[model samples]
Target: MQIQVKDISKIYGTGENRVVALNSAAMTIHEGDFISIMGPSGSGKSTLLHIISGLDAPTSGQVLYGDTDIHKGNDKELSAFRRQKMGFIFQQFNLLPVLSARENILMPLLLDKRQPDETYLREMTGFLGIDTRLTHLPHELSGGQQQRVAIARALIAKPAIIFATSQRAILTAKAAAKW
Candidate 1:
């Protein structure tokens, strides 16, 4: 899906504590583009990602996925749209401690009442070197292992667009390259 981010701005707090994370940011992401947003700490890269991906609302302006203004959707509609069209790899590995790696990786599909394709699942887990860790819970895995599980979960549904924050932050250089 092609994404169009209009003149969006995000502001936090009020009075003396007001912080402007993004101001009049605009960009167009065509389909199949491997765009990366790079900036130092306190910059608005994460904020932009969140807004563009419908994870957060822009204080003003619009984010459109194709012709639809994603920010206009209600909670359920947005959630469904995201599940169907997008994959997200968060900077923080947001894994459920009680769920096994397999469960976490399959969560998206399960949420949509769909089943996993065993062949694809095997191929993906094998490729990521996490096949042996599928039964392990998040607490039982190493940091890198957990990150790999997050990556696998993002890719399992074969989403059209993958929004990642610090995709390589935890993996070894070689491991990051494969992803």
Candidate 2:
């Protein structure tokens, strides 16, 4: 499996205010596999994604990417792992209001001190049907268009796993299937 999570558990707070975010949760995802996690509020979907992406550590159990234990890695290592191997899509289209679509899409590559891959960037913009809107700011676009820009940004890195929240499920499903 490309991703394996075992006996994972997460608890928030303690004593009377304790909340179990995840309870002995386990799952496996193979390469090129597509899956959906559907549930009502407070069902641990976000927490599971966070743990798998190495954004948050579980209170107990382990998250493995291939044979490596992600939780065992230090913060800098985990940050690099996440930057190079994972893509996250939140419900809120998290785009910088001041930047144009192209700039926003290129932000990750810029941050990693790498030049933008023009061909890939173009392909991503084309795939998301936002090529013409590349020069536009976030506030200038409609909700769906803004979401498409965010999707392009996420795909620009070509990560192994794309973790998406519920609101972006439709776009995420489409992008995952396309890739």
Candidate 3:
């Protein structure tokens, strides 16, 4: 499996205030596989994504990518892993207001101190139908357009897994369909 999550559990708060988010959830995902997680509100769907992407650590259990334990890695290692091995799409469209679409797409490469691959980047923008809007800011685009830009940014990183969440659920469904 490309991704293996074993016996994972997450709890928020402590004592009387503690809330159990995930309880011993396990899953295995292979490369090129498309999976969708759906459930009622507060069902740990988003929490599962966070654990799989190494964005949040489980209170117990293991998240393995290949043979390495993701949570066992150091912070720098985990950050690098996230940058290179995971893509994230949030419903809010977390684009920098100051950066253009192109710049926003290039943010990951720039963070890694690597130059953006112009050909691939252009291809991705074209694929997402945002090539003409490369110079436009997020505010200038519609919600759907902004979401497309977010998708492009996520794809540019070439991640192993993409985690997304939507409170309204419709956006998540739409985004998943678009993807």
Candidate 4:
């Protein structure tokens, strides 16, 4: 899907303590585009990602996925929309401590009540080299291994847009994210 950001700005705080996180920032993410965002600390990179992914709203302007304004919806609406359309990889793995790796990786599918294509699951698990680690919980895996599980979780649903904040996860995502 093509993503368009128009006249976007994100401001935080107010009065003397006001901060402008983003200002008139705009970019187009074409379908199948592989792009990297680079900036120093507090440069609005994360803010932009959050806004574009509908996790956070911009202070002003529009973020369009095709013709639909993602920020146009209510919390529940946007939440469902995001679940159906986007994926995310956090800097900190957000796996559930109570769930095993296989369960965590398949959470989205379970939540959406979608059938897991056994063939695709096998391919993805093999691709991530986590086929044998499925029964282990998050704490049982190494950092890199845990990160791989998170990546697989993000990929299992085949979301159209993926927003990632980790370098290692991003590298793996770039390799596996094929349209």
- Backbone clashes under 3 angstroms, per model: 0, 0, 0, 0
- Candidate 4: tens digits of C-alpha lDDT, residues 14-116: 9998999999999999988988998877899889999999989998999998889999989888987787788888888899999999999888888778888
Report the CA-based lDDT of candidate 4 relative to the real structure.
0.88
| Per-residue lDDT over 1-179 for candidate 1, one digit per residue giving the tens place of the 0 to 100 score | 67899999999999999999999999999977999898776899889988988989999999988899999979999998898789989878899888999999999999999989999999999999999999999999999999999999999999889988774445557776897
Tens digit per residue, CA lDDT, model 3, 1-179: 48889999999999999999999999889988889888888899888888888889999999999998999989999998888878888878899999999888878778899778789988888888999999999999989999999998888878877876656668678799997
- Worst-scoring 10-residue span by lDDT in model 1: 165-174
**lDDT of each model, Cα atoms only?**
0.91, 0.86, 0.88, 0.88
Per-residue lDDT, model 1, residue 142, is 92
Instruction: Give the CA lDDT, 0 to 100, for residue 168 in model 1.
Output: 47
Candidate 2 residue-wise lDDT, 48-125, digit = tens: 888888878999999998898999979988887787778878788889999999998877677788787888888878
Candidate 4 scores a C-alpha RMSD against the true structure in Å of 6.5
TM-score of 4: 0.89
Best by lDDT: 1
Off by over 4 Å in 3: 169-179
TM-score of each: 0.85, 0.86, 0.88, 0.89
Better of 2 and 4 by TM-score: 4
